[model samples]
Target: MTNDQRDPADRPRSWPYAAAAYVFAVVMVGTTLPTPLYGLYQEEIGFSSLMVTVIFAVYAAGVIAVLMVAGGVSDVLGRRPVLLAGLGCAAASALCFLFEGGLPLLFAGRVLSGFSAGLFTGTATVAVMELAPRHRRGRASFAATAANMLGLGCGPLLAGLLAQYAPWPLRLPYLVHLGLAAVATCLTLVLPETVRHAGPRPALRPRRPSVPAGTRSVFIPAALAAFAGFAMFGLFTSVAPSFMAQTLGVHNLAVSGLVVFLTFAASTVGQASLGGVPAERALPLGCFVLVAGLAAIGGSLLATSLALLVAGAVVAGVGQGLLFRAGLSAVSARAPADRRGETTSAFFVVAYLGISLPVVGVGALSLALGLRDAGLVFSACAMVLAGSIGIWLLRAVPRRPRPGA
Candidate 1:
């Protein structure tokens, strides 16, 4: 009997999409596990700030390369295989960190983590939604996104707390994640395959991101909003800790991690708050809120107020969440079923670019301009970009007629 023809009860334990999401979250936790430890790495390895961003940029490059080449592999090869491969990458990434000797290992771990995430991002999301009962598909989307953000948020918190108070700072976090990855691998093996295989596997190669021509109107705005929102995340992840340590005189590793956590936590809340709001409304509003958050963050930099920085992180995270979910939903809803994986991958390509490119600029600017001034410039540029997008969205999205008039 084919895998699909197997009895339902014979498959691994099922709970709508919970099993997939659990695996999803575990893998993602590994991706950002190094966030809080960059400072420690710097102390030990004696690298400049530019190297930090360069290391981070290498990870982004890996993600983009995978998305461009193998993003749709699950669509042909089946989700479970891709997921298992991703877990293998995660395991390898954890091992890299566990035995990291210097810059080479650090860079290898990050790029491996990127490859793992690139695989999981679109594949796991589609698997979750596909596995859910029809009625719960909407909730499944949220589940996938929440798992992504919450897992990303929790990594630093976990690492920060452990590194601050535990025995081994760098070694412990990856060790814990390695165990989690093992469990996720077992769970993924049992999870039923969502995509059916027909005959022999097709050769996978690099293919440009293609959205159905009809979906472009929806795809463009949503992708742009995602880019803007993720840029805020990239900034926080790459440089916020440094800002806290260097400028605000906050040296507590836990505090640094918490500040970053608050941003992603706020993003989760923002996404949940969208309940039934239309994308037309949510997208533009998200842009406006993001701009406000940027302005506040800029103000915090100028004033050197930690409170303001925390507040800005929270506000900006919320805005990022709002646009991220709304845009993802709009794009996923419009994408053709057969091409969902590639379309979703394309969307994430744009988002990851937003996260990587601007932050690299920040790192470069820090050399000539210093962290404070670099941050100020980034905030100003992002604010203008977000504000312009908001204005365009407002004009481009047609207003719905009043209920009766």
Candidate 2:
């Protein structure tokens, strides 16, 4: 049978879907394991906090580079192959970290990890959605987001605990991840392929961030909202640990990781709360909540209050989670089916840009000013962006007609 005419029986099963989700989760966890370890690396390598942010930025750079070039390769080549390739990169990243003896090696390891995540982000989401049981697409979206958030949250938590209590702090965590990568690779091999393609493997091309025609109007507000939300996420992922250490006099890595994890876990909660809410309504509401969260975070930074910081993280994470799901669902729902993958990739490119660029700016600013001052600035800017988007979304997205009104 032709590619389009393949039997339905050959499609992926529920077990494979679950397996893929687990693999994606593992990869995400590995990427952020270094969060709690940055302080350790600082003592070992003698780099400044700015240098640490630079190192973190390198990872984001690697991810964007791969996304631009290979983001859509899975659409043509098949999800399993791309996923395996990602796992291979992830395994290599772990190995790089395991033996990292210097700053350059750290950069190299992080870059590889970023590339691995770049490959997985879009492919994994598509894989989970495609493999989900027909009746559970909504639930599957939650599962995918939850997996991403939980894995990210767990990374630091696991690393912090290990670093605090384990025999070999740096070496052991990556070694454990290497083992997980091996398992994920095996899972990828067994999972059924989803893409039905007949043409020869396409030559790799540069990945450009482009909105589909007619989507530009809606895409701008959505992308801006995403940028704002993810910028907040980037702050937590990249610098919040140091903030806890330097500003609040908190030196416990486990506690630091827990704070970061709470933000992401709360995001998972926010996303889950959208069961009955329409995407349009959720979009603006999410933005408003995000602004409040940003305000709280800024206040926490100014006051050096851990309670305020944690509260802000939880609130902002929820807003981000809600907006992300709503925005993605809206765009994906509107895109043409054939171009869905590309469009989705485009949306994420914007999201990840939000994750990287603004955080880099924060890093650069931290060099001139202090960390707390810089964080306050970053939080203020992000809040403004989110608030603007919320207002636009409110005006642009039509209110859903009430049932039997």
Ten residues in a row with the worst lDDT in model 1?
A: 1-10
Query: Candidate 1 lDDT, tens digit per residue, 1-405?
Result: 122323333334447368889999999888878888899999999987778888888888888888999887786778899999999999999999999999999999999999999988888887877776655655877888889898899888888888998989989988999989988988899888876645665666667777899888988888888888888888888778898889899888888888888999999999999988998789888989999999999999999999999899999999998888888878888999877767888898999999899899999999999999999999999999888988988898887799989
Candidate 1 has which clashing residue pairs, if any? none
**How does each model score on lDDT?**
0.86, 0.84
Instruction: State residue 292's C-alpha deviation in candidate 1, in Å.
Output: 1.2
Candidate 2: residue 287 Cα off by (Å) = 1.1
TM-score of 1: 0.93
Clashes of each: 0, 1
User: Which parts of model 2 have CA positions greater than 4 angstroms off?
Assistant: 1-13, 135-138, 198-209, 399-405
Each candidate structure's TM-score, on Cα atoms with residue i matched to residue i, is: 0.93, 0.93
